[model samples]
Target: MDGVTGLDVHTLGIIGLAVGIAIALSFSLMSLVLRGMAALHVWAAAFWLLTFAGLAQGYDENGSFLSAIIGSVLIALANAAMLIGIAMHLGHPLRWRGPALVIVLFLLIQVGFMVWPPSQPLESAVFGLKSIFWDGWMVFFLLRAPRELKAGSLFTALVFVIDALFYVARGLVSLHPEMESPELASLLTTSNYLFGILCTFLLSTGFTLMLSQRLVHDLRVAANVDGLTGLLNRTALLKAAAPVLQANREHTHAVLLFDLDHFKAINDRWGHAGGDAVLQHFTRTLREGGIPARALLSRYGGEEFLLLAPCTSANVAVTLAESLRALVERSPAHYAGEPIMFTTSVGVATGTGTHIQRLIDTADAALYQAKRTGRDRVEAMVSDPSAGDRVNEATSAASALT
Candidate 1:
């Protein structure tokens, strides 16, 4: 290995081979452990093909015709795996029939060439064209990926585009009569090995980062979202609603607490499964109830949900609550060919303060009142002046947060 410019050609090839093996192993573990990301399995297979291709190249250098043919086929298969993996990641439907046939035809042609090797220029042309075609396919898929993929997608695209262009240029250069010389051919091969090492390192690191980023995003979503209803959890709701309430300079903020009436009876009659279905049914109605996107909707607890709406006035809050109540009353949950009717009692309270807890407490008081007076109705609570002043002062001083 060179000491100044880093490792020599042989060392770089060894390192590249090791990296390829490590990538295959790492991705295999990721696929087995995660299970959900099937694309990692595809990528693992791709790296395995890459490793085989490398080994086959060594056999080819030793004049092993059969091994070289197998390696050539593995190269095409590797490219195919990479393409399929990208498709899976992007939520795209992969129609493999056409591409599979093309790969088969490519393999046959390469095997035929190995059986009766062509002259230097002809062989270079064939090999270069094959490389360009597959690299171009990669570039096409990367370009078509959604913009939301951000850093990972962009980095992968750049690497593929450069690799594709390099193959094209290499093909054009190989047409020169000078390229037929043994020294030139050997230099070209060595340069390619070096470049492959760089490509492998870049691709493996980029993909790992992409996987890490996706894991982080999924974790964040899981933390904030309620598993049963797919709504925000209580913590997330309060965290989100605080800013809206605090910044309410012109409009009053209203908190509406909803509780399903006779929920335990539904559980007792229809079982836990039926109760769950009813809850999901009500959530669907709420989502379709034309609630403003800015409003925070959350699963406060079992059979209870909270909505913080920035309304024009208390009247608007009451109207909104009444409309939601009516919507739930009309929609019925169907379980086992039987319709289960249910209703929700809502408590709406409008206030002019940054203290979200105070608002929730006031709304909860009204909610209990609704439950006591009648099972299915909406109730509004007026904030006491002295209580409001104390809350505002405490909210300004302590600014306690959950």
Candidate 2:
């Protein structure tokens, strides 16, 4: 069969072989910089080696069974390397047993072929069965992967399934005498070779997309999460809170600012590492306590945190803030086999308007008041003159109590 520009099967194989080598080199370059990209590098190398083996056989048209047998062995190793690369990408523990066993089996198959050479049909059947089983195995891992990777994995798995079916069809065709005619056989072989190259291209594209998707996911997590406390950082908190503030303009929402009292003294006594331990302990306590899931807790700054709770009145906000204060005072952070007790001052402010910044400012003022009056206490300030007379009066009453 002549492809575009009258290219024969041998020419196509050479082209495929060239493309495989380029892909291998590209992956090799990437592996040097990107951690874990070595797996993909190995996959590309295996693919190229298999292509090299096929090209070798094509070049040696003479009855040198040795070249073909060597190609088969390379195919076995290539399959094993492909599996190893996939397992590494999926974050599975790399195991040597599977690839080792595949190598051993392929070596034995070579010996068996040399002893009593099987017919074309028998050889096709044996190879096809092994290919189908391994392809199925690859598909299994893809299907069982995480949801984030499902789309890409499934796309690649479909290619593997199609390749498996191709082998099965080839094996069946080899058994039929009519299909074995020189013309029909040549056409079938050319078609198989073309389809195999297409499958390789698709697989490579899918794998690249998988890596990109994971990189984006990881970057998002890194941007949003606080490295020290694992809470949402200040920037992320503000981004998340903006929508909630807009929607709850008419509803009551509370913003509580928490500052660890005398935190500088703790840092001075325990050093920075111990101070880090205390901060971690405080964040853990906030999570473990009955903090509502709907609320957003963020590390506001060095020793300060912010909790934004929607649909809560001034009275409820005060109660919640008082509970948090007590919880922190009770929880002691243990470091270096000694208990380090600490206390927090909380400032509570309720808002019935769309202005998040105003609420935050009011909460900060109350927090200042809490620290000024005394540490380890909760202070309320719901003073918003613009939010109608009733709201202002209610907030004024709460402020008066504080």
Best by TM-score: 1
For model 1, where is the 10-residue window of minimal lDDT? 393-402
> Candidate 1, 343: how far from true, in Å?
1.3
For each candidate, how many residue pairs have backbone atoms clashing (under 3 Å)?
0, 0
Q: Which candidate number would show the highest lDDT if scored against the true structure?
A: 2
Query: What TM-score, over all chains together, does every model reach?
Result: 0.83, 0.78
Instruction: Judge candidate 1 at residue 367 and give its lDDT.
Output: 94
Q: In model 1, state the lDDT of residue 205.
A: 70
Stretches of candidate 1 off by over 4 Å are: 1-16, 57-69, 108-133, 136-149, 384-402
Q: Over the full model, what C-alpha lDDT does candidate 2 score relative to the true structure?
A: 0.78
Looking at candidate 2, the ten consecutive residues that score lowest on lDDT are 386-395
Please write out the lDDT profile of model 1 over residues 263-289, one tens digit for every residue: 999999999999999999999999999
The TM-score that candidate 1 achieves is 0.83
